[model samples]
Target: MNMRRNDVNDLQVKVIPSTINPSSAELKCQSSCRLPDRSSFIWYKNGQKIQDETSSTYEGNFSPADSSSCALKGFEHHPAPSVCVHGQSCNRVIYTDRSICASRGSSVDISCTYSSDESITSSFWFSPDRSHQWQNPSQPEDLSKDSQYAGRVQLLETEKGRSTLRISDLRESDSAQYHFTFKTQSFEWRSSLPGTTLTVTALQVQVIPITVHQSHMEAELKCLSSCSPAGRISYVWFKNGQKMMKEETSLYSGQFNPGDNISCALKGHEDYRSPSVYAPKLPSVSVSPSAEIIEGSSVNLTCSSDANPAANYTWYKENEDSPKASGQIFTITDVRPEHSGNYYCEAQNKIGSHNSTLHLIVVTDPGTAITIAAGVTAAVLLLIIILSVFLWMRKKRASNQSSEAEERPDNRERTQPEQDNLHYASVQFSNNQADPLYSNIRSDQLHRHMEEQEVIEYAAVNFNRAGTAPRTRGQETGEDPSALYSTVNKTL
Candidate 1:
């Protein structure tokens, strides 16, 4: 007698004889047996049942040549059993060991086994706590979550008789243990022990500096990734797939921040990017003493800017073949019509560049130009008018002095007597032309005129003594008897 252990509602016993002796097999009675609380028995031999069997232990016999044996089957079906085995109809008792799992940027496979050879029609996989139902056997082709598996999930079909589930796109979030279930004929699935904890990791390569100014001389870019405690992180920068030697970070001293952030600075690589660096705009330019140019004339031009890197100047001639000249002065030795056009200059540095334009035109020598001619004509006209006014003023002053002399009573009295005496002297001198006293005749008229007035008389005496007595007199004063006697007495 063999006792079968069961956890479900059923208790069973099987009797397999150690040796079969004859056509009829009989058994001696066992006095005591441990049976179920509520049990029934059935005895069968060669697909046939015995006619009567009531006692737990029986001694019965049979004839030979029948090829028969007696079998006793006791089943306690009041409560359901917990363990399902072959030829046993009870709830299944599934068991599996705990598991540990891990993966990288890809998928992971978790496996479980059963205790019995039960036929399974389907399978399912879920996360810890069974909150997330990952997959069902009927629909296993969906891979939207394939990214979570890192693109490398595969189910194992042939294994140690276990239902294994493979998950792809393993991320950090997929680090928990998973549960699995296998469906049997009754559409019932028993869960396996929670599988191993899957540790999903990845090697990341990210560009640190995301933005930069155009035509930046030098730009520093960093690439970093999350690494295992045992793994090392490496970085290299690529431009259009061509690696930059200066952009390498092998000698960098700093590591990624706790949250995986890093940065670097680039310098002195002016041509690293395209176009040009961003800088302040160029300053407006102007020229002083603006002139319409002529041959052999000089002009000055100035350049300025609002830039950080100080602006350099270069002159550009538009529609002309003149060689470029720097600085402010452009001396045109012999300017021609061809030298006339639009001219500009470029002021620039690493910061920025700007352009200013000026128009040049050809004309005659400014010294001898028509405009100068007009200015000279006006100046000459003004000088002539000033000279004419000056001469007119001088003549008017002479005329005014003559009129003033005629209008002054004191000086005019002396002038009228002098005039009358001059008339009388002229008559006397004309009458006595043949005599030596012709000069004395005019002086006698002045003496006769002076004798008529005391002031003139004194003046005559003084003038005769000084030998300057005017010949305008009618007669000599000394020839007068009265005057001669007075002079002699005075001399006495």
Candidate 2:
């Protein structure tokens, strides 16, 4: 008789007890049983009834009306007890679905479980917020719920005990809460947990940087992340996957403001160590734009060496020491022809150094003064030629005039009467030709004859031009013509 009472109590709580802990037992019973209306199921212990029993099964102190007892007559196991599961919202016979958003084109799962020990034969779902009721909705529903979830709603292929609903071809309209209804052999009830809600969102992607332009004076390197409610996050810089010692930028020309771009140096080991986070270490260097220089002019060189901590700059002359030229302009005020050579600048930092060479070719042309000198030389040579020609012609004319003057004789005049010769006889003969020194002749007559002959040969005076006359024609009858001519020639 006592044993029968224990057996009856065992039948009241139907779940099999786990051997691991006999005290802790699960309540497993039909999830769809109906109770006698107005007369609730009573829990009995030792042939006595208990009211409002909450335990799933009795492990110790069996007695009716004991709060520790797990016995209820005419009522199977149900999950509506107020002690709610952690992280869950409510503890009710039916729970509202909460898991909403899902990826597009993917299957959406709506999970539900009825908190009752009654055997669930079938389960159905209804589109909440839409005025529609389901009569055996698992089979077919009214046009309102049917038309809305028509091609997208269906029962899952799992066993009915799982009571899970899966909807395919989910669109944006299917994002509302759903109601799940459970059916058993004796009664029907909704799930204590609400149907799972689904919110389909577009597939989100990340924004990544590809390449940065070198010409940019200042630029940022960005690693775009999926747009989430959480704004911009922090970034970690890396070099060859090694985390950088520092995080901020100092040498960069631009600031790395929130969501803004970043810049870094690139003059190290000839390689780049990409950053781990979304932001990349933009290994960049500030390079001065190429400049123009006159062949003979000088200019100072300037360049920037890219680096994380920023690099120092050094000026050089073809890899030589930088001259003490102020500023970046290597000015040579009095630049000479020999002050020409190759020039360049170097920028350096703790990481490394960068250098570029610029060939300085000084330009020049012949000066105006030199050109003027050459022109003067040619003009003077031409003038000398003209003067030499003129002088030569003048000298030739003067020589001819002097020669004519020497060849011509001066004019002379002779005016006297002529006389007849007196008569005289004297004869002498010598057998031998006597020397003219021993011979004695008329001295005056001999001398006169010689003079006459000389005058006739030498005289050709321009008497017409001088206004004079011939002396020989003027001799008288008493004088010999030879003697008179001789005397006139000798006297003239």
Best by lDDT: 1
* lDDT of residue 354 for candidate 1: 65
Q: Candidate 1's residue-wise lDDT over 1-492, tens digit each?
A: 345433222223222232554322343222134544433333332213443345433333433211122222343211111222113333232224233333243345566554234466666555543344536553332232444544455666575446666765445676665545555665443322124445554332322322333433222333322323222323343343344455444233222211122222122221222211223354465654455466655556566655433556778788656647875454455567777777787775543356778777767666655576678889999999999999999999999998988789878787877656523221112332433231223365556656665332221122233355444232543355456335533432
| Tens digit per residue, CA lDDT, model 2, 338-404 | 5456655554332233455555434455354356567888999999999999999999999999987
Q: Least lDDT summed over 10 consecutive residues: which range in candidate 2?
A: 411-420
Q: Estimate each model's TM-score.
A: 0.23, 0.25
lDDT of 1: 0.44
TM-score of 2: 0.25
